[model samples]
Target: MLSPRFQGLKIIVSDSAMRELFKLGKDMHDVLEVLESGYDAPRKRKAGTIERWLDKGKKTVNAIIALDYNETMQEECWVLVHFGKFARNKK
Candidate 1:
């Protein structure tokens, strides 16, 4: 389950991101937590993103989300398209 903060926005995880999630030992909750509280990745310009940094042990994971609408469902959703850039933790 997700928090009410998400409200009407649907949450989706990409197929490749699923593998990365396992590699980082993270789940949807962890991903949501990171999205809820974020650090702006000003340098990254992937798919016109609202960027955020997520940490997992020695590596820092990137959570790239894209906003999209479901015309058929008549609702908006946030897609976790990419989540596999494991850089060294900055802080």
Candidate 2:
């Protein structure tokens, strides 16, 4: 089941998406890294951006986005990424 906040995301769990995630060296650490980076960036990180980081594959990115939207996991802090750089936004 998915949360109401994530219901808006039309994310589907597909085999190919899962396979691609495995192919991209995905793990709890990597997912957490992406999540942390995604959440701790100023530029409203989109699903596409995270996908790009995940080996530049659309499926990989979508998977991460889905996990994030579903709140299966969350970032420890929030920040912003601007012009390809990260900046801490919280004290």
Candidate 3:
């Protein structure tokens, strides 16, 4: 069962994203949690990308998504392009 926050939101996982998710041992629940509660930020105009951050219990995960707004259907769909742990620069 999906959480209420994910209701009416269409999510598509890309091949690359699926591979990354498997590599990171993340499932759809993790992705949905990020989309529901993570910090959302706008990205470049290409494909209407958006960046989101999810705070797991031990670490944070970052997700890149491409969004499409369907005016005819009056729906918003998003594709997960990439997702992985949030890497911090160690300077």
Candidate 4:
């Protein structure tokens, strides 16, 4: 059983994607923590979730791109992971 703190996270992921991303490798929570800390640490701590930070990061990255600015691949990956479209290829 997960803590009530994590209950808010339940709806963040779809059933299928949650199953896929929840177990087999990187825990989504940990990933969200990392990304959230990178972008917004204090706010993340308050919300007890990283979803908003991830959304902000995505918006920031897109804004940068839209402005015809350059961002590193690493920067783009932050937004991509939340999307669940491309899973990291196991090597």
Task: Return the top candidate by TM-score.
Answer: 1
lDDT of 3 by residue, 1-91 (tens): 6422244667777899999999989888888778778986544445467778876666678877777665655878777888889654445
TM-score of 4: 0.26
lDDT at 91, model 4: 57
Each prediction's RMSD to truth: 3.3, 12.1, 4.2, 15.2
Tell me the spans in candidate 3 whose CA falls farther than 4 Å from its real position.
1-7, 41-47, 69-76, 89-91
Ordered by TM-score, highest first, the candidates read 1, 3, 2, 4
Residue 67, model 2: lDDT of: 37
Estimate every model's Cα lDDT from 0 to 1. Answer: 0.70, 0.35, 0.74, 0.31
Give candidate 1's whole-model lDDT: 0.70
Clashes of each: 0, 7, 0, 0
Would you list the clashing residue pairs of candidate 3?
A: none
Among all windows of ten consecutive residues in candidate 1, which has the lowest summed lDDT?
1-10
lDDT of 4 by residue, 18-84 (tens): 4545454545554444344434423322222233333332232100001111143222121122422
Name the best candidate (by lDDT): 3
TM-score for each model: 0.70, 0.29, 0.67, 0.26
The better-scoring model by lDDT among 1 and 4 is 1
Candidate 4 local accuracy as lDDT?
0.31
